[model samples]
Target: MSTSSPSNAISGASSSPSSEDVETIRKNRVLSSKLYFDISDTMVPLIYSSSYDIAFFGLEKLHPFDSSKWGRICQFLIKDGILQQSQIVEPLEASNDDLLVVIKSIFRTLCQKLNLLPKRKTYFGNLNSSSNVSKIIEVPPIALLPHWLVRQKVLYPFRKQRGWAINVGGGFHHCCADKGGGFCVYADISLCITFAFMRLDISRVMIIDLDAHQGNGHEMDFGKDRRVYTLDMYNPDIYPFDFKARAYIDQSVKVKSATSTNVYLKKLDKALEVAGICFKPELIVYNAGTDILDGDPLGELKVSPDGVASRDEKVFRFAKEKNIPLVMLTSGGYMKSSAKVIADSLTNLSNKGLIDLATPPLGTFLCVHM
Candidate 1:
């Protein structure tokens, strides 16, 4: 069984919790737990993201939470002292391609490392048996275009914009071309974006990944396209263990060297400013990762929930204020405090202009509703 604490994920929020809000939080935890539990073990692949959450949130401390549901789901994958493994096979690999063999071998090795059983076949199953695999969800692409086009839409857009912003879970930046993790960075995002554009017959797009981890995959995915400008940020020394020795890259920003929300945001603000001054993108894709929150076990920066909230607000509002069409996605988030980010983001979007809530920041009060 895995063990991680909720407190370990967040140091503290900026304000005190009201008793009523506390009760609501208690109820939400119960609801979230139940929602996760009643789900099937077969759904593990579909919901591995939850395990990512478990790994990040410190499942043991999901107080007032009964983990039996997630526990059973996790353990089943470990039957016969082995967990199951899956891989995203390259679409272009030849039938007898050595790369395919290598990928299969790697899957076997990973299963062995995790003590997991190998389930043969490329995985493409529904998260739930009743669900339609054909209806699989996809991430859109990052849009890089000119400015006046951005002003025509709800989000900041470029002149005659024709791109989209895609989102996904975790900062899976390692899954890029050069990384040997076959497929392009932002592969999911790109595929979705391409399909959307083809279906819509639109052209031009740029991607922006704001996760705490460098958008390594996105960088590789769109490496050759001058039209695709990616901005990835993360600490180079930690996690992904493999890239630690590499020199500080100009392509992506390192949060570890300068660990503060102000610096990170300033860096991002600068990147966006440059993009605005140069690219003039029409469609903006924003990947809002919550792992940057201070005390996040997986995060290196110390941005507060409010800081994250501000980042989201600024990004979306800027786009909206600029009239840019945008598509937003939940990318990386290791901390349960991310729950607050999600709640507040939606609240910010929903309570875009309502006033007289009597609360200093309306976002804080919405957590209770979440």
Candidate 2:
């Protein structure tokens, strides 16, 4: 119940790069990056690593976030006979060079300055530092550790895999180019899309953010950029009340607190229809957060586990019907049941033939846009 405020340490006024500079730097960095390595034909595009789970000296328990859910999701899938452990693709850590592509210059500078401090001194210098890194991640203990440790343990796994990947961790939708918030320390979604634009040779991308909370990070980062289209359906009464960021969303579907599963799915069906007519994207990034399930302390919506599975099915169906490569990130769910719900949803996706783990070559299905 100890939730961090949305407006905590991050400033909404962080500077954006000039359009020309953004394109130049983002493209160069993404092209020179090593995170987008080739996967073998035998490996599925589902990206995950044991290192993705965060265990901050057992202090993570003090926060409301589920630090271990990422590993648990994979475990459930394996236990249920839906996937084999060897089938999952382990991703390379997103190095500083890779992150420079999408991260704001100011943030990069701040991180560098923090890294320069002596090991004897507290890296952050002040516990109440307004850096917004710890507050946004909701793990106050992280404020005491070195920034390098935070990046290695928490953020490295969020790097983009192939065009079609399920990052069992990372849906940090609240962080942006120059700021971090709502337990989101980095802009993984933005970074992923940028990598796709350059490495995957993708142009138009659509973001289907179905988290219980509005995906303000990517919205803020991609605001007014015509390359990306956002369809965010969230409970407006939740943590981040970012009206300015809301303006960036192409289609905003507001679901009130305590709304039932039936009504939520009905709205999603309509939203997908509207989105189809609005944009013809080559790729879809689905932020599938399970926090909306009933009894979740944060998301507050009343959707059942079955409803969550159906929601993912609809999104996958939409992408398949459109012949677009899809990248899914398990974003923003912290309840103990969050992992199980996501695993079940993935099982459902597999059962429906949306995701084929046993296929010899994932590229056959994913190379549609390429």
Best by lDDT: 2
Where does model 2 exceed 4 Å of error?
1-25, 106-132, 145-163, 362-370
TM-score of each: 0.48, 0.84
Q: What's the residue-level lDDT of 304 in candidate 2?
A: 99
| Number of the top TM-score candidate | 2
Model 1 Cα lDDT, one tens digit per residue, 1-370 = 0112323322344333334443333333333321111222232111222222222123224322122222232234334222333310001111111112112133333233243444543321111221221111111111222323222221111001111221213223444422322111223344333333433343555566666666555454556656555655667665554453122232465678337778767877776666666555556556666777887666667887777867777777667666765655555565545654555544554467421111222121100000
Could you give candidate 2's per-residue lDDT for residues 18-114 as a string of tens digits?
Answer: 3553455456666666676666777777777776777767866877778789899989988988788887776666656566566555333432333
Per-residue lDDT, model 2, residue 11, is: 30
C-alpha local distance difference test of each model = 0.41, 0.76
**TM-score (C-alpha, index-matched) for candidate 2:** 0.84
Clashes of each: 36, 2
Instruction: Give the per-residue Cα lDDT of candidate 2 at 286.
Output: 94
